[model samples]
Target: MKAILKQHEEHKRELEQLNDHWENSARYLEYTKQELEERLYHAEESAILIKEELDEISIQKEIEIQRLKDEIKDLRQEISFLSSSQVNNHRVKELEDALNKAMREQMEFKEKLRIAKEQSEGGNGEVTEVTTTVRVIVKVRPFLDSDPAGPQCLMCNDTEVQIESKKVGSAKCFMFEKVIGPDDSIDELFMDLESNIVHAANGGNSCILAYGQTGSGKTYTMNGVISRSLNKLKQRFDCESVMISLQIIEIYNEQVKNLLTNDPLSRDWKDILNLSEIQLGNNWVSKAQDLIKKSCHKRQTKSTDSN
Candidate 1:
């Protein structure tokens, strides 16, 4: 009986020891498993965070690419605009060149035509020679007032000279001193010289002058005669085969002034008087001499035919 009880107690102690060891082993295993699960969970969380960061970076890269694309598009538009402008500028230059070429050709054609016409007529060419003559005409002042409504002459105190006469003719000399008076009628003065203007018109030159004091109706008479005569001549003698050259010069003080000077008040005596200094650049007068020659030749031919 004592042996059995001792055996039982030893067995009981062995069983308790085995139970405690088993329990400790199980607890250690559970702790190791929990640590591994915690590590795995933390790794999963880190991976998720990395994925989110990568997604954000990808989005930023896409946005940067889009912005660059927009910049490229704007640059392309600017380049296109500049190219179009360059083309237009080239086209305008071509047009201007064509126009200038056309004008030059036209002028050359006109000169050729004139030369041909002049060559056709020959022999009795004395009538073709351009003759220059100085002429004068005297007429009464139409307006009796000095300043429109004001009556009476300011300087002379005369009650306006009667319309004595008007003469149109060629003079053998340049200067004519007081050949007319205030009381001569136009018909009476023009008796012998009425037909003389016709001869002068055929290629001869004439000058009619009125010289006197400032308020002596010089301006009135000169302007009136010039206006009426020029209008008549332009209308009557402007045929293509006939050419008339008219020059109106004003002599102030001792200097001859050009009627067409750019500066009216330019007081330089040399500039006013020197016809050689006159700049007729690109004007119709550039071909004037040729035109005159052609007209004179035509006139000479016509006169010979008539005779």
Candidate 2:
């Protein structure tokens, strides 16, 4: 039947989207790994330079200690030879004081080198990496064909987004990590986010929520992102051993309904008391889109506010 083929086509599209998302994620992770490696390399080089400077200072200290020891030894020999002829007590005392001062200076220099070495070798001679914070980004999708193309309220720059109010004659600006314009592709949107997705795929749980007012392109944007994430997971795991599950949930008027259910006519909230018990197993992909269509149809015609 035509319906069966259409359902099959939808599944294929879902799989394709998943594959693309995952591929993008893998690429992003590889790029991040390279960046970290580069940063570590530079840190190591800097550590080496610091060690070299400290070693130079240590070498200078050794040379000075040797010079001072040699001078003290010569002075001692001279004092000993003069002792038999009644050398001046004041001169002998001054020479002894100078020798003691040199020894003290040598010990102070060695102590400085010890402290310097301890600091330079904090992480097995590797400098600790700096931690980075998560950044929020905002993106605006392109206007649809039916929408008017003219000056809009939204404004975006590299680091912020501004929305102007015509009635209030004022603008509100929100700071973000990055801002994507309407002309940007979904790939551009996920360019920086793929690393996080890849991380999540490797047993790390991640939640991506698409939230906005009605008809704000939230579904469109999230669909693209979710598809990409699934694609990346495919690459990381074996196809034979891995199983992917999809469940679409619809909640209306404070009542929850599984959009991937068998009975498309199960829209009455009174029929189900506890929404928490609704569970669609891993095999819901077949009727997911069709059930969503039926749910939408019921919502538009029925008055959910009434009994």
Candidate 3:
């Protein structure tokens, strides 16, 4: 009976021990489950935060895209306005050109009538020959930056020029009233021509003509001559007693255009001149220079083979 009871006690203790072990395992599994739940909760919160950030970023991108679209629309409108303005400006320029042409034609007609009336008054159909001394001045232009490198072909002296001839193997000499070298100054040229040309104009009609190749400094020389001649005349004549009248005309493409009337920006030319007298002073000279500049600006130019 004691052995049976001891065996029963041993079985009971083993059952107690198993129960204790099972309880400990269950407690540990419960702790692990809690930890997993906490982790899952924190992950869900992070996902929500990230989704919110993405939504904010998307909104900002939309705003930026709309702003850019607005700017592009404004720029397109501005370009359209500028295009219309350019067209209007072109049409205005065409009208101004036409007005200038009409005025030039009217002036030319009046000049022709005046000339015809003078011829009628003279009444002598026979033309009178007036002997006037003719002087020819030759000027050699200096080498420019655009000029090609080559050997000198012409040697110039005070009153003559010698050109080298490769075919003849000789230098051909030509005599002129005055031969101006490339090194000569505009003042030197003006001085040479003044005594014969400018002074003679006071007594009778005198003409100074410039003819040359495209880039041979004809316009430059003529401008200098005009300025110097005006100053010399101002000094020679009494401003109070003698009045000087000036007229400038340009011929281009077989058409004669009055430069004084062509420039729209300049003041009325009649204000500078009167029927009975012309105002001559520093003010007049300044006005004249300004008018000349405006008129020259209106003169058309085209590129040539030599230039």
Candidate 4:
């Protein structure tokens, strides 16, 4: 019995040790679980922080990319604008060159035509006498109040006129039979033409034609010439022996009309009457002057760009 009791006590002690060991093991397990849970929580927080940092970095990168794109777009636009400007400048240069070439060609052609005409005239089978049949006179008008203000491009002397070229940067000279400057008087011009044209009218058909741009004093000069010429004719010829006839006509818009006709509006052939001779007298001269004035009033006039 004693042995059996001792064995039983030993068994009971073994069971208590086992129970204590189990309790210690369970406590250790609980502590380990708590530590593991805390570590997992910390890891989760770190992951969230990393995600936020990544998002911020991505946003900054996107902003930088957008800024670069805008800069590139602006650069392209500037390049395009510069290219267009260059093209426009090149086109304008080409047009100017073409215009200059055309002007040069036209001048050359005109010179050739003049030479050809002279050659043809010389070759004609006739007694070719060097006579001043045609005379070209250049008249430079004085500046008027209505004219635009700028540097004078034309320079003139007694027999030569020079024009400064803007493109060539040189002066081009032209020779004429007479070059009437702004300072030259109407009397001088009349004196120049009187011996050649007015005196020749007595023997042959002679005409004094005034050709010029609008507002170049053509009418004023012609009126003065006519008055002077009539007085000169009266002085040269005896009134009884010489018979003077007057006919006045006007050409406007490519149509001819007799200014001295009974009907001013009539364009018929009958309206042009045959010129009759009358004794050259003061009465006839006064009538002629009056007729000229009437004809001048009937002339067609319009404003031009040059005027």
Q: Pick the TM-score winner.
A: 4
Task: List candidate 1 stretches off by more than 4 Å.
Answer: 1-196, 264-307
- Per residue, candidate 2 scores C-alpha lDDT tens digits across 145-259 of 4654433767776588787876668899888777766645566566546656755656665566666566657766876776666566556665446455544555665555554
Clashing pairs in 1: 133-205, 135-207, 135-208, 136-208, 164-184, 164-185, 165-185, 165-186, 166-186
TM-score (C-alpha, index-matched) for candidate 2? 0.45
Error of 2 at 292 (Å): 9.0
Model with the higher TM-score, candidate 1 or 4: 4
Please identify which of the two predictions, 2 or 3, would achieve the higher lDDT against the true structure.
3
- State the lDDT at 56 in candidate 4: 60
Give the better candidate number (3 or 4) by TM-score.
4
lDDT of 1 at 53: 62
Clashes of each: 9, 6, 0, 0
Could you give the candidate ranking by TM-score, starting with the highest?
4, 3, 2, 1
* Candidate 4 residue-wise lDDT, 1-307, digit = tens: 9999999999999999999999999999999999999999999898667656655654554455344334433443454465667766665555555544543443344334334334444333222222577888776666665866432777776699888867768989999998866544565566457655543644765678999778878999899989887777666666556557777776666556677654444445453544322333445667777878887877778988876
For each candidate, what is the lDDT?
0.45, 0.62, 0.64, 0.64
Model 3: per-residue lDDT, tens digit, 211-254? 89899999899889978876776666655555555566665665
> What is the lDDT, from 0 to 100, of the residue 133 in candidate 3?
72
User: Comparing candidate 2 with candidate 4, which one achieves the higher lDDT?
Assistant: 4
Worst 10 residues of 4 by lDDT: 121-130
In order of lDDT, best first, we have 4, 3, 2, 1
Give a tens-digit lDDT track for model 1, residues 102-123.
Answer: 4344334433433333333422
lDDT of 4 at 300: 70
Off by over 4 Å in 3: 1-132, 149-151, 165-170, 197-201, 263-283
